[model samples]
Target: MDNLTHSLVGALLGQAGLKRKTGLAMPTLIIAANIPDIDAIAVLLGGDEHLALRRGITHGPIAMVLLPLLLWGIMLWYDRWQTKRGARPEKRLPVDAKWLLMLAYIGCLSHPLFDWFNSYGIRLLEPFSSQWFYGDTIFIIDIWLWCALIAGVWLSLRGERRGQPSWRVPAITSMAAIILYIFANGLITGRAEQLTGRAVQSQFGIVPAMVVANPVPVQFWKREMLWRDSNHYGQGVFSAPDQVVLDPKIGQHEMSNTFALAELSKDKNAKAFLFWSRMPVLREELREESKVRILSDQRFGNPLVQDRFRVVVPTEQDAK
Candidate 1:
């Protein structure tokens, strides 16, 4: 999920009454919600290094424990610093160390949960386990979620400004609605994957090794299905009301030679990209005497968006 969504979720949680638990609760929640993304700095390393480090250690169980504690200590120190300078807000509620720590945990835990809702995937256990997990239920950036969170926070804030007794109602209701929406989308993804799997088996006489039902923007009922078998992989559309249409342009792997793959895998960039790619495909091109092999993850590797999510390895001889 995007940082805005994470921030909005934090605001919604605060508006839903978590803000009352401690001084600076809202900021703590908002910052904690986006803390794990500190790993985003890995992009500075260039190439596929970002993929190798992203959503890994910083989002793992170890960070989950340490990050909140760090945030709690910082917030406590900040509060005391403000008091010493006589700049603390007079209207602010007294800070409760316990509640502040609890809110930090709540906010930080929400980060990985929301991140796992997309097909991009996340490594929950990280150092303990490098395995990637995907929800494939929501798009990375979802307008619908944004609208709900924004509306909820707005309404709740309005109620509070007007001194209404039920100021938190809107935020709580919005949270419930978002939860239901996520659950429904999960069901949709499950059904789409199951139907696509059966259809692929029937049409191609091969059971797919993996089937991903990726949700698209705006049209939440529709999914872009990417299915892979031992020998081939293809894309298709799965629309609601029982419609499944598979594209005819099936893709095959051209890098079948063991020695060639070993050589290409020797490239750190290639290794990292392959480690992160869920649906990998390869294309070989000749440049003078050397062969340039470009490996791509089918999910984001269409011609329109080719440069990203890809790795290029140059070889002197052609792949056998």
Candidate 2:
């Protein structure tokens, strides 16, 4: 999901079965987990943010199947050279080179598997297919899950006994908490939508065109409710999210066509940059030149963000 999150997971995996000086495994898993994102290179060097490139070759099953073996081979060669020179490799991996290959495979594949829980999904099947697969679980980085892992690592390290600690307990506990949190958030979001809907009906005396609810920090929420009335707009933050009015400045008819509306409504791109993009506050501008540009609202601090992904309109009005 993010670097820190990946590091935490790597640490957890690193500690699982390695012997002396195994801390290297933590970084190994961390870097391995992120190897799939090397497609970012395709972004920087190519300057063409094509979906096939970003979500295709790298995230596909082929990468997970092939890259780890390559990494292990490179590592093996480096280790053989160091040993011949009578030098020890720093953070030496303890397992036999061949066995380590297997571990590398597991570590590398786990990342894409876990990432599928998010709505963004992944192109795991790759060259076989480009379809995105999603599991609709986990917030990607739930604090509760982080806490469980951290707490376990801390308690085990402090050692009520020897250098060994009971990491198993914490890992199991954390996994359970992660699952529970995902399910809970799913339910909570639905309830929030209903509450928001009733609140809108009670206040505006009309049902909104749409209601989208999502969790925020501190057990609170932020929502976006679209009103059907022309030139009318609805916006709010809970618990007063129900009250909305016709904001003539951004009316219903001003909303773009079906494709534009779908892009905004399911602004998964915005959701991808949760910290920097506020989907609800984002504004879509249809240039008179017939191009679509989704702009961020400065009020939410989205203006300072640098990453912006371009998506095709599915159809073009004219040939380029």
- Highest TM-score model number: 1
lDDT of 2 by residue, 176-210 (tens): 66567666655655665677667667777767665
What are the runs in model 1 whose C-alpha is more than 4 Å off?
254-256, 302-304, 316-320
Give candidate 1's error at residue 165 in angstroms: 0.7
Residue pairs that clash (backbone atoms under 3 angstroms), model 2: 231-251
Best by lDDT: 1
Error (Å) of candidate 1 at residue 291 is 1.7
lDDT of 1 by residue, 21-54 (tens): 8899999999999999999999999888689899
The clash count of every prediction, one per candidate, is: 0, 1
TM-score of each model, in listed order = 0.96, 0.60
